[model samples]
Target: MATIKVGVPSEGDTLDSPVADRFGRAPKFIVVEVDTDTGEIVSYQAVDNPGYTAGSGAGVKAAQKLGELGVKVYAGPTPGPNAYAALNYLGIKVVTVTGVSVREAVKAALKELGS
Candidate 1:
């Protein structure tokens, strides 16, 4: 019954929305909870990106927020250096996704995680 939490930078609350291009500056983040036993998505929620308007250190802040939310995987475009470092330090896997919907990105990430 273990669940995996994946974070996707997106434009809306649903998986059908486009994934954002910038991780740190994305307008919102979609947190998807997946059932590891069945590889099925259980639930999802959209959270406002707190670092979207920060003048500096946005990546770091974004990483911290995701960590706080218990996000073990992040799927989106390349994150800034600071954000990448922060996510690495937190043991969160970052997956590259492009020109795809949030749902597609999450499925790819889950596949990469082998869960």
Candidate 2:
């Protein structure tokens, strides 16, 4: 079984209110790690959204950075075409979900990916 990494956009207090600012002054990413075989969470962490603007290079760059960190699946609000393509090129899978907490979304991805 392969391990998969997942990332979620940060909602200051919850998933409804996503932080609008870039990861620069307002870093907002919650990354999670899961074991594909057992559907168990291996790790959970928060990363600074380095210089990424929503709907811009920031999302693509962030996805690439996450790929470097070994994340294989990214579940968040829908991403831009550039970011989606870039992530897909990196062999990362992008998913979309609504109204779910970051952690719950990660778990769902783990199960869906069969990681």
Candidate 3:
């Protein structure tokens, strides 16, 4: 099965961490490895968002960070326009979600990404 990595905006570095409502300003991102055929999470990592404290261009910064981590999909609340554009430029798929936790968001994202 193919594996896809999903980056979910999160409040903390855990699967149960609450899903952050703001993409660019999120404290961290829960990077999840999902199995495409089964649509299950195989592993995950949490990376602090450098853009959380940025005064400007946070969206672009956050997008670049995720891209650097090799995240193929972004699973979170709607991102700002600039972030969306940057993600698009990086060929990252964006999935809008209202899930409460990072784990939940990952599942939702996998579904949306056709995994």
Candidate 4:
């Protein structure tokens, strides 16, 4: 099986660059990390939005990208159904958190998954 993976939202709030607003639409996505048995974040990357808005399947596209990267688990909040379905189809587990920092959420997810 592929190594387990995790993704979290970026620190920046806006997805668009000052100049890119004209060149292309803004992107929004979470930061991703890959790991081995240690459960430590090994590889990290940002999954940018594919289109102008999150409504344009950017989230799903991001999920697909994560799948391609062999991500097996994602930690986030209240992901939409489409995103959830995409992750499920990709064999990635989704762990949802409410009102918690990304770090805490990850720890909680790890605990819950017994990883």
The lDDT for every candidate, in the order shown, is 0.91, 0.65, 0.91, 0.55
Clash pairs of candidate 2? 35-115, 36-115, 37-115, 52-58
lDDT of 3 at 45: 94
| Model 3 misplacement above 4 A | none
> For candidate 3, lDDT tens digit of each residue in 2-101?
9989999998999999999899999999999988888878999999998899999998999999999999999899999999999999999999997588
- Cα RMSD, each candidate: 1.2, 4.2, 1.3, 6.9
lDDT of 4 at 69: 64
Please give, for residues 1-115, the per-residue lDDT of candidate 1 as tens digits. 8998999998877889999989998989999999988878999999988889889988888899899999999999999898999999999999998789999999898888784
RMSD of 4: 6.9
lDDT tens readout by residue for model 4, 19-107: 12110122434444535466665545555545345457755776776677666766655556776788888888877654555555556
Global lDDT of model 2: 0.65
Q: Which stretches of candidate 2 lie over 4 Å from their true place?
A: 12-26, 53-56
Backbone clashes in model 2: 4
Which is the winner by TM-score between candidate 1 and candidate 2? 1
lDDT of 3: 0.91
Rank order by TM-score, top first? 1, 3, 2, 4
